[model samples]
Target chain A: MSTDSDAVTAAVLVIGDEILSGRTKDKNIGTIADYLTAIGIDLREVRIVPDVAEAIVEAVNQLRARHTYLFTTGGIGPTHDDITADCVAEAFGVGIDVDPRARAMLLERHKPEDLNAARLRMARIPDGAALIPNPISKAPGFHIGNVFVMAGVPAIMQAMLDQIGPGLARGAAMLSETIEARGLPEGTYAGRLGEIAGRHPGVSVGSYPSMTQTGFQNRIVVRSKDAAALGAARAEIEALVAELSA
Target chain B: MSTDSDAVTAAVLVIGDEILSGRTKDKNIGTIADYLTAIGIDLREVRIVPDVAEAIVEAVNQLRARHTYLFTTGGIGPTHDDITADCVAEAFGVGIDVDPRARAMLLERHKPEDLNAARLRMARIPDGAALIPNPISKAPGFHIGNVFVMAGVPAIMQAMLDQIGPGLARGAAMLSETIEARGLPEGTYAGRLGEIAGRHPGVSVGSYPSMTQTGFQNRIVVRSKDAAALGAARAEIEALVAELSA
Candidate 1:
């Protein structure tokens, strides 16, 4: 759910057996999370379901009910297992057919003879859904209700996102500031850091550790929609890190 | 939920703000999915929650109840935001404290005088949980009930999993084979591919597309625990791809 009234929340439903079986490492979740955050939509949850219709339909219905928007990737291809469009239609209780507009979009890349039955599978759209144009691939994605069904391939999904970006209903952007705690391990400053977080309810604080060529690095981040409040929290965290480092 | 009685199911709870804000790309999910699949656990769902205690507690309780095993990554550090241990304790209605064994584990890396309050935070574990040793960092993960709380660092998490691997309850391994369908769009063979997949009740068939130097390359994968069934399905797909290529 969206945390604040001004926050637009979203959930990603990645549909593919390749992902569940670990044959494919999903790049879309991180990519879409970054994109949505830029436009003030909080990515609340991400679920990866196999290329099964019942699984896709169940996930779509459940996620769409809880979030402001649901974005699905994969399973919209021309393969037998590519059942996302049909499943989405069933979820919304709508009929689906090959849209002339989507077929026309495909024709931009493929010749009339090349638009065989297999290729035409990309043109099917759920009834009452608008097309999300794919610039890289002619196969268009679609937006029905709060669900946006996009291709699984990272390049095509990105292009579709760029196409639909301007039309999205964005909320207040969450501003974030990061402070590196240089060589200090998290344990050195963790106690007071929690107290500092407790003092600032407006901001969310987190500490992350990463391995680098030299050694480990810890970063503390403060995030909030309020710039002034975020600034105050950032300053406090910086001070805390300084005190501990000294 | 696990589809078959013989299948062991799991859910991943990724807790961190770095992932949600897209500051850090999570490598743990793919690593764990591949690991679990190899060991015969079906990862049914994945949820990424923030550092908030309520969010962690809610997700932990919900997922732990739904799946046979729950693996959590992130928030087990020496910082205040690293409250996963506490949240996990709350989820299970248990008391938590710094166990002597865990402190001893930390002492292997840190001098006794250096084990300050912050570093000691890593030692606090829920009641009745067994430590999952971390060889890289010496910060131990814990397994309690059906839940495993692990580090966010990929290296440490992997090491901990290696340490705890032998103790896990494993089902029959799910095996897979891939067939390359050269120079074909998924739609060209999708209809017949579905028919073949329907014929094989024991195996799952999936089509995946990738962009290469030439153009689009498609691969069909057949997966199942039964080797003979998987072999039969794989043979059928290879034949289909050859026919389509011809």
Candidate 2:
């Protein structure tokens, strides 16, 4: 992995019909987003597409071209709908077949006689890709170019993510501080918050308003890659909250 | 709001930096997905983009052009980051300003004196749009063309969806049945499942594998608009499972 220090940005492409059909609520997007942020990689965008090969191929190509890295989860199992690997290969204009390395990983869990044609489907990897080992399940994920493909199951995806995490180049980690507005609603402090955000170009300020059982709860979040800028913005937001509360 | 019987589809655009930063776990995408499915509007795709004007505008244009309807959540608030409405207007190349109807709705919740500039921002609506009433906070969402814009907060978004749902022209509602594989792993039944899926072009079959306390739990879900096709696929899947188990 090249040690580039630029702002590392990533996009997540969740491939599944289950998620779009609401059969499965996606836990992977949040997990991946949190993981990328913690690793100093900014998660810029996310797209959820159905199991259609055309949709999958188009999304992979579009996202991979724009972001520093594109991570995909789901549609990699041993069923008819599991067509992500082929779609990714098509997206990159590469040939795909059962890789010996991936087949070896499957051997750790399945006996040679038990590895049927369907089971061997799990061993298909795009040409020139590196395997991302799955500790929970023997079926490995793979990364080609700047895209990482992993399992849809949260547990297996987590394991694969851990394996892929170390090799990624680090960027300046974004620092953030949240200041709760307590009882003060966003309408009470939004004007001033906007002004504060405008003044701090180095930092991004966001006021989130959510409804609690009692009433509206609001929070002001300040984020910046620069530590001093983050601190300054957080201080201003805290003071704004204090003034609004008083 | 034509009562057309053709299959209706939608795409959701979630706009917020909080979600991208992982500061907030997104609840809107799943909620919208389930709602759309229940009403016979197939949720085709979902995109989560940050609070950037260019990104929001581009996504809005792309999604609205492709799907039968486009639903957007978040960024329609009273802060600097709340730029969704403006971005949407820019996407459609329409003029936008505070609408009288939206302002009237806001008046139900906010007093004239309390309707500050930031609060007034909630009343901004694009040209030639119909208002979606918000009962909770009374800051109405709106629809211009095929795109419906709603709040980021779950409660407010749900209310707006309820208002929008009754007017939508629904297609045939998809019917689904899930068959449990008991202790049978996907690898055991994947081959037959693939054959069954291939035989039934009218229905979609998906095999999902999850780990439980006992071990792996797998389920085969068959969905189709035609009940006859759904039943045919389900029966074949059931027979395959029994044969494998015996």
On TM-score, the leading prediction is 2
What TM-score do all the candidates reach, one by one?
0.94, 0.97
Looking at chain B only, the TM-scores across the models are: 0.96, 0.96
Assign candidate 2 its CAPRI class: medium
Residue range A1-246, candidate 2, lDDT tens digits: 112347898999999889998989999999998898888898889999999888999999999998899999998999988999999999999999999999999999999999999999999999999999988778999999999999999999999999899999877887788898866878889999989888888898888888999888888888888899889888888887887787
Pairs that collide, model 2: none
Local error of candidate 1 at residue A155 (angstroms):
0.3
**Candidate 2 chain B least-lDDT 10 residues:** B1-10
Runs in model 1 lying further than 4 Å from the true structure? A1-3, A111-117, B1-3
lDDT of 2 at B106: 87
**Regions more than 4 Å wrong, model 2:** A1-5, B1-5
